[model samples]
Target chain A: MTITKKEVVHVADLARLDLEGEAIDRFAGQIDTVLAYVDVLKGADTQGVSPTSHVISLFNAFREDEVGTHLEREAALANAPDKDDENFVVPRIVG
Target chain B: MKLHQLTLYEAHERLKKKDISSLELTEAVLDRIDALDGEIGAFITVDRASALAAARAADDRIASGSPAMAGLTGIPIAVKDLICTKGVRTTCASKILENFVPPYDAAVIEKMKAQDAVIVGKTNMDEFAMGSSTEYSAFKPVRNPWDLSRIPGGSSGGSAAAVAADMCIAALGSDTGGSIRQPASHCGVVGLKPTYGRVSRYGLVAFASSLDQIGPIAKDVRDCALLMNAIAGHDPRDSTSAPRETPDYTAALKDDLSGLRVGIPREYTEQEGLHSDVSKAVAAAVATIEALGAEAVTVSLPHTRYVVAAYYVIAPSEASSNLARYDGVRYGFRNASGTDLLAMYRNTRSEGFGPEVQRRIIIGAYCLSAGYYEAYYGKASQVRTRIREDFETALEACDVILSPVAPTPAFPIGEKVDDPLTMYLSDIFTLSANLAGIPGMSVPCGFSQEGLPIGLQIMGRHFDEKTLLRVAYGFQNATDFHTSKPKR
Candidate 1:
């Protein structure tokens, strides 16, 4: 149940977060404390209980494929931190 | 009463009678905010020009004497920063979205606009609605109105504090665990978290989708019902929204609880760390309900202890996935130092997000990791099923369950902020209602020995906010707790 500093760094990487030396250790200690506390759930007798991802039972909300009124391109890019006239700008991915 | 201090219903009545203009009321509330918000730190943004313009438009609507004029017409209402407004900066109280303005209004905002409710401003909250105390807000911490040094219970703390301080007539706040009710309890106002699907979540910034719901924070039960009436409805945009019809919540606000069976959960009263003043207040509240002809019964939620544990796993798992959208390319803060895409993503997130948010993301990533998913997230989900069943069985015997909204009243601002587990435990009573997807509300019950407000919690069957409202209305009518305001 104990999360090590190395594991904390790995998890932070998985979450797209950069955790440095002290933050990694601090998060490791904190996460371990929380995990240990939540370990109390291990004693619950949930023998055959089905897991509930959502409380309400909802099916796929299908809609007819048709063009509808939507956000204009200008509005869509209004808040983009880095964007060109037509698209969002980002670091080059494909080498 | 001063125009700023008028309740939503009271203002509506005056507006209907042509006794006062919406412009005057909006001005009064704006003036109050101008005077008090410096001390309260309740609002992140207050748009005076837009609010005044909206009020004038509402005045025009009132002048037209249109038959379609609704109850909320011309009433100024503050929105939580998390809920999107078409052109307003909707920062879920985070640095990442500090400059982000949504292009579209949330479904609730659209509904409120349709009713001609004036938009006053956006209230502060925990960054990404992640913390129990508003101390986690990136902008600033919201102070409790009753005692300035104490924390306003959060992540809806700003909305609750705003309403309590009469900065706005009422407000809309979202609840995942106890965001709405806990703050409402601390601020001595009424708050309701409708059933998971009772209100649409189209633009609520996705905290924990399954557990998150939008509700009201207001001065009393009637105003809560009025706001609920305005916002509670199914929307196609939110696929999880229940297809069922929303009842007129105001019609359900009868002051008689003659047929109501109020259940007192033994585990809640006996739970450790409950403040003695809170216990006494809840006991007196139960007696008051009993005197109003409602029979008090004992009910058991056998999975009570497992709620906080299960919730930490489930909510964070959802949050980690939902928050993946903030990668810096599309809106929000970006770190300019990164030379590559992976570095860009990491640097942007690590810099944009605050410490509490990062802590949660790490916890979520760790729990849902390949090696531990079954033990953490999967086990928690199963325990969630057990928790839901506990409510189902308890509600079968009683019409509504009553308990203390929070174990204690508002604590000092810095008391539990650094201690995440202790802060998490403060929401012990309120999280179960969210896990069970039932409606829960908080009504002012009494005051602590230190003069802090204590609230009584009422929870009812799924999609049955009316019962919770009814019981709360009956209790509020019998007591003056809801009428008592803080002396600032």
Candidate 2:
């Protein structure tokens, strides 16, 4: 199955990416090539086989519900691109 | 031998014997990096001040007769750029995080520091660990020490290159799909990918969460084991960390391979693109194991053909979800040219991420998209189950499996960068181990006709790193391949 340029743009929008003229064409081609290669999975016989999300079977790794030492606000906000003293500043979400 | 060329164990012994100070060892390593890294491009950031301070502290600790001194005490070790180092700029070789300094040390970094291992620098990698070759790194591509024109296998290319060039005593590398072992094979060093949960993944910038594992790249098997001893264990921070007891990896190193059963997977040997030289070298390695009294047995992994197909779908899908957090808000690069929130995110991500990363994200999003999920991601997961079961059944017949690490040695820098499918196929042999959550390692086996190094890959049962280390140690003990260093 070939991926079209329109599909590529749609996927990019869903992925929150901006693809311009050349990049859109390039990504569409590359993604199509990869998809064509990976289409071999459709031939594999996986009847009754359960999908393995995690290789090691561990579940509900719960710790005690106690407050612990966490990253201080200053440190947490240290790498923020734009931040006030209290919170990170993004483009106004609710205009 | 120069102080910089000494293995982690040798350096530790000298420090313990008062024959050398940690300051001197660290200085030698820093000097090596200074002289060679300009050509090799192995380091993204060299923390000279912090490294020296840590070295001096280690020296004082040793002098104080502190009982806590460990193998990595006072040893300068490079870390791959993806693993978070507190206060150090940890860019996963991407523009998105070019200047980002992590707020805290990763779990492995914390463990290494507890052993007093000096943090020499953060090494380069594929941008967000996306590519097989370090060519995808935003800063620069890491050149193989053996051949300057060749690419150092990556996304942990810098870690392996640094170790091979003696820029550091040892280094930490993360393996998602051949990130550690492939580069270690190409650079002619030792690298291991512990079972998925064998090493805590906390603070490692996620690429493919289930498949990503932080392991060691070192000069030899013993040093790899030493680094593993320091880093492998359970942590409350990583939910996937194995709750099992950590064994003394060094204890697993014995010169005897007696009573060992080595599995030779027919599918691997018969796989397309297996280089003639690599096949010969691995054959010779199997013979060496047999001479050491190992019983060779043929094993079959029927699902080997589908590994790359399955891996690409699964890894990128997870990466797409994991990387969605980098949308110009909390940290990393931001392009403020956009007028709205959605536009800001799109502009920031497009401008920040490199081409290969953006491509993977797009592919991943497409795979996990509503209409295509069942055919691509879901089918790939089921194929993954068959691959895992293939290993389980094959491993039941033998103690460990051996194969060629890569189809061939390090290729020239730009050879496969444009051809992503070829690059993905190069990782075919290494991806199965990760897919199955089994421990795998690469040890230098022989040199190709053109003088590039070839590595023999040894894989073992889930959480059975000891046997892999044991087989590697035995082979290294019997052969001089691991001792052949790259000429400057």
Candidate 3:
């Protein structure tokens, strides 16, 4: 029921986060405490339980696949930190 | 002409009377934003030209005799950064999306614009709505107008603080695990979280989607209802939105709740960690509700202790999956290169999201990952069913449930910053309603000895926001708590 600092580091890695010195240890303690709390769930009998991810039995809340008018290219680029005439430019990802 | 102080109700009347023009209201509000924004730090982006253009159009609509403008025209509104605003930068208080502008408006924002509600700017929030105090916001934490050292409660903290400081007439806030109500309680304003799916989630930046709802924060209960009336509806875009059956919430305010049965959940009152002054203030609020002719009965939500435990499980599980989208391809703050795309994803998220957000994501991923789903998500679902059932049984006997909105009123900014458990427990009284998928509201009931605000939370069955509002309006009529303002 315990996760180690190494395990916490791996979890952070999976989550795309980089952890360092105190962070790894600090997170190790916090995650251990949290897992200990999660361990409380182990006591309950949930044999017949269906995994209820949503509280309301809601299904398929999505916009239709119709083309709606988009903001002009100017408005789209209005808040971009960096943008070319037609594209948002980030750090060069080209190999 | 100070834009911040004018309520929507007042501004609407002036616009109708021709005593003021929509452009003037917009100009004044914009001017106030210009003058005070540096000190308050309430907004992330203020759209001057677009707001003025909307205001001018609103003036034209009123002159053209459009009835929709009658209800909300010319009133300035603010938006929390979590909701998309067509072209406005939506950071969710994270630098990863700091420069991200949604291509479309959220359903709520669309509805507000249709009614000619002038969107002044985007307010700050906890990065991805993770923390109770907005200290987790990657941007500067929104300071409480009452006392700068204290926090304006999270996620919707900026919206609540702005409304309190008269920075905007009303604002839109998304509540996920008490994001709206907690901040409203801290800032001493009214916040309502509608039944899950009562408001459209179409354009909201997803954070635990099922638990998240878009709601209104305003100076009083009626303004909250007005904003609700505008935002609450079935949208073809959001399939989960309820069918278009209009409930006249303002009209419901006229009904008498003289003989209504109000249940005060004994479990929350007996909560182990409640502060002493909080206990006194909640008891006084119970008395106020009781004096207004509602029978206050002791009710038990037997599974209360498990609500937060269940919430932390499900919310983060969903959050982990949802937050996976921020892999640096779609939006903000991509790291300087030399790394693989996967490594870029890691560095960007690590640098972009704040500590609290990263912690939650890790917790969420661990819980839902292999070998743990059945134990955590599966078990939490069962506890959630029992919790919802408890409320259903209680509601069968009582008209409404009353409890403390937060265990403590407003804590100092960094008081619980170091401890995650301490911070999460503050939402203990709130997570149940979201779990139950029912409507809940927080109305100011009294103040603590040091002049901090105390909020009384009222819970109603699904689609029963009318009853909650009726109960709150009746309480506000009897008490001056709603009228009492924080002297910023």
Best by DockQ: 2
**What's model 1's TM-score?**
0.99
Q: RMSDs, each prediction?
A: 0.9, 0.8, 2.7
Indicate the worst ten consecutive residues by lDDT in candidate 2 chain B. Answer: B64-73
Give a tens-digit lDDT track for model 2, residues B50-142: 999999999998999785688789999999999999999999999999989999999999988988889999999999999888999998999
lDDT of 1 by residue, B1-488 (tens): 89999999999999989999999999999999999999999999999999999999899999997746797999999999999999889999999999999999999999999988999999999999999889999999999999999999999999999999999999999999999999999999999999998899998999888899999999999999999999999898898999899999988989888988989998998899999999999999999999999999999998999999999999999899899999998899988687889989999999999999998988887889898999999999999999999999999999999999999989998998878889999999999988989999999999998889999999999989999999999999999999999997
Model 1's i-RMS, to one decimal, reads 1.0
Give the TM-score (vs. native) of candidate 2.
Answer: 0.99
Native-to-model Cα distance after best TM-score fit, residue B412 in candidate 2, in Å? 0.5
Tell me what fraction of the real C-alpha contacts between chains A and B each candidate also makes. 0.87, 0.91, 0.46
Clashes of 2: 0
**How many clashing residue pairs, candidate 1?**
0
Candidate 3 — what's its lDDT? 0.83
Candidates' TM-scores?
Answer: 0.99, 0.99, 0.93
Stretches of candidate 1 exceeding 4 Å from the true structure: none
